[model samples]
Target chain A: MNWTIFHQQVFPIRHKLYRFALRITGSIHEAEDVVQEVLEKVWKTPADQSATIRNWEAWCMTLTRNRSLDKTRDRAQRRTAPIGQEAEYQTDGADPARQIEVQDLTGQVRRFMEDLPEKQRMVMHLRDIEELSYEEIAQVLDISLDQVKVNLHRARKAIRMQLQRVFAAEPVQTRNS
Target chain B: MKEQANIQALLDRYWEGETTLDEERQLKAFFSAGNIPEAYQAFAPYFQALQAEHAVQLPGNRQAVRMHRPLRWFRLAAAAVIAILLTAGVFWWTGGPAQQEQQALAPVMPPKIETPQPALTPSLEPAANPVAESQVPKKQTRKGTLRKTRSVAPEPAPEDTYEDPEAALAEIKAALALVSSKINRSKHTLEKGLQEVNHVDILHKKKKETDG
Candidate 1:
């Protein structure tokens, strides 16, 4: 394992790989394990294989996805999606009540995303949260670009529908108040 | 108002998965802004969740996965050490012991024959009769003088006659045997010559008695 390549190329993108793994395996610990496994694998790659790899980020994301899926399949148990820590969210200029309301809605949106189908959830996570290109998402997921677009569309539409219901309820609650 | 419409349009494209990464960023910015209109406020949480997801980091010590670089020179050094050891082993196996054995056997070599005696050369002079010098008592006196002379002179440094100690021993034995045979032959010649001299002396004394 060459530490130079791993530290320079793989270390900087560790969070990116972790996020992708978390989206797939749906557990923080499992996701961390998957990222660690991917980084070690990248570190141990022979010089010839490393030379052939053009994009370290994409390769690591792909490895994370595969390792996470493998770990998920091995356990064969229901996995929970990771919820962003409340502390991690920027609540910088908001009133306390507004912060609580935004945090509640954020949890609701996270659940909506969690309810999505596997392909749709992965595509949405990669595209919106991780901000990967359609092509890059396809490369990581080993799916067609068209499939990435289709899954992303369905995933967003589902979340939007769920949001609409919440928004519709908000107006009613406000009118009643 | 135009900016709001454009953001609304970008948001629509974002849901359709038609927005580029830059356009999505714009949408995320607009939704995250504090002054969003009441209608768009419902979607603010979603953009906030995405930002929060982006902000998520891998927890725990980063140093856990790091490894130290291996000591590469150790391999070369090990190989060189093995090579040197093998070469030394081969030398010892092939020839080292015999040379050692030779050195060890050197101190126990049989004493050298004092064959190059300078005094012995004068005994071979033709001007002297062999019968006159063949007396046993006179020969013992000459040997005593030679031994004294040998003790006074510094001995020459010895050189290795041959690598094989056994062969050098055999050659020295053969030379000693040859020297003894030559000495025996000379002793017989001197006895014969001395008998003829005694016969001549006897005949001369009888003729002198007759003449008297």
Candidate 2:
């Protein structure tokens, strides 16, 4: 998109892209890079300047997802690399006040999802946060529908266990005690 | 010994990657909609995410995406090109006038001197130098007369009213020497140009004679 339109229409979605990416990747810097890289890839080469993309969100997510996976692969390859080293974007600030913590179970669940495996985190995000389907996830991921199910189920089990632990640890208030 | 007691275990096995595709699809549908039993409610977002992922359509643009690159690049390129073109065009336009002036002036310079060379009888007129006299055509004589008649002031001084007429006369002598050097250079250039032009003319005439 042009700068004006990007500012007017698409820039508003940047935080959304950032948030969604952070939800999946669990690192603010990586998520920012994912969003930046996706945007760059979309607009880099003049050749094939336009594509037949019917959903910008889906297209962007697919690109971001693929890039994040690549980064994870590269990081895995370089086992000596530090986390978020030389990463461009840093949403987290020096002050603890900058940390966004919604005082609710959803926020708690999100934080819990952060502890999940990379693939599981993405699966959880794709299934829960983005509200995508097994078929769509498979398409976006270039995997089979059954693989999506396995991943999603595993992700759910982990999240479910974690949330249960978190809720149990917190003093619960019954509505009709 | 029916399997009702192991149903929970069977369901856990389904979630733990042992389920067949049909079984998974059943679970997907079962968890996708409606009350989504509290046990499954926590997993609902994942289910919704799958649907979102699937819905990832093409660049969902109806009125076509706007491009800013070419316009940005072109505006800059066009401005630069126009500036370069304008400067070049000015040079070209002004350059034509100088070429036309040279074309008009070059032909007239050599011919007037050579054609009138035979008309000077400077020895008969009591001139000092015979060789200079011979070279002095009527045009050269007239040019000398014109130079002398136009200004009788100390020649270089522009106004002969110099307190020391000797210094003024000396200045006039220096000016004459400079003018003579310039005239000699011009005469040499004219002669060379004539030689070249005559050579070309000869070749052209021969070609025409043969062709004719």
Candidate 3:
């Protein structure tokens, strides 16, 4: 679309797209690159063609997903550090102890997400973090509604189980102390 | 207690992937409000992480704004370059205007074809008969010869030729008209060739249809 409309409509969604790319690529810099590439692609498309797209946000998300996946593949060949190592969980204004706790929790959650299979991770991130509707998730991921539900279910179950294990260990550690 | 019960039920539905976004938001709100009971503390981090991730925005959309401005100019420059190259390529392919003019004039100034001169004494026999001396050469050259021969005749005096400017202008006009007609005749031949090609195409199509 024209610059005015893109700024108004499409540009506002860069955060969402960046988060999605970040979720996939794991590296903040790579995610930024992917988001920029996707935005450039959408910008390069003729206004008329982009105007015909029914859901520009979902379209941008889809582009982000594909580009991030490609970057992930390239990074895989290079065998870089696992995703989420660069994730900086903000703990604004908290006490130092609370901040460390929050950071540790954030790191654990990010690792849990990174450990998820691609589809499940994407479904969880889109639904929980990005707050997309099921239909929008399906549209962005190009999967069926049932597949989205199943994947989200599996992802949440995995995270829940991990949390439960950590919870179960807490009492033992307290008893030992 | 009732709120906890509601959250518990919502969490069940959420884990099952059946909660509406509103219900999910309700769950997030309850946990994020803090002072969670010991029973649900384990689940708080998951919701907290979601909030934390949501807070994670790209630092600057200003970068995107800046990027698009230069991108617009880049696209325009690319388009202009392509257009110029295409125009230049077509002109070069068709041989430019000067070459076209030379082609158009070629037929009017037919090249002089030299025949094998008969082995004879240099004679002034044909000089008295102006018609015999002025008769144009008749022996046609081979098809491939493109060389133009210089005239052996001495150049006419400029005064003799310019003496009647009106007559000279009329002669030039007549020569141009002859060249124009020859170009028209060549154009007609080209049209005929194109029609013949069309006829062949039509016949080929008909044969293909019949075979199909």
User: Which candidate gets the maximum lDDT versus the true structure?
Assistant: 3
Superposed model 2: Cα runs more than 4 Å off: A1-17, A45-56, A80-108, A172-177, B1-68, B81-212
Flag the better candidate by lDDT, 1 or 2. 1
Q: Calculate DockQ per candidate and list them.
A: 0.17, 0.05, 0.22
Tell me the native contact fraction for each prediction. 0.43, 0.05, 0.42
lDDT of 3 by residue, B1-212 (tens): 99888888999999888999999999888777877767787788778767777876775532444444634544565556556555665565446787666555543454322322221223524566666455523323332143222222122222234457898799779867966776566556556655665576566546533432
lDDT of 2 at A148: 82
> What TM-score does structure 1 among the candidates reach?
0.57
Candidate 3 segments exceeding 4 Å error: A82-84, A87-101, A171-177, B60-212
Alpha-carbon deviation at B168 in model 1, angstroms: 62
Candidate 2, residue B49: how far the Cα is off, in Å: 15
Q: What's the TM-score of every candidate structure?
A: 0.57, 0.42, 0.59
Task: Give one digit per residue, the lDDT tens place, for model 3 in A75-174.
Answer: 8899885544543533233476655655666677888998999999999999998889999999999999999999999999999998889766773111
* Global CA lDDT computed for model 2: 0.53
Error of 3 at A61 (Å): 0.1
List candidate 1 stretches off by more than 4 Å: A77-105, A171-177, B69-212
Ranking by DockQ: 3, 1, 2
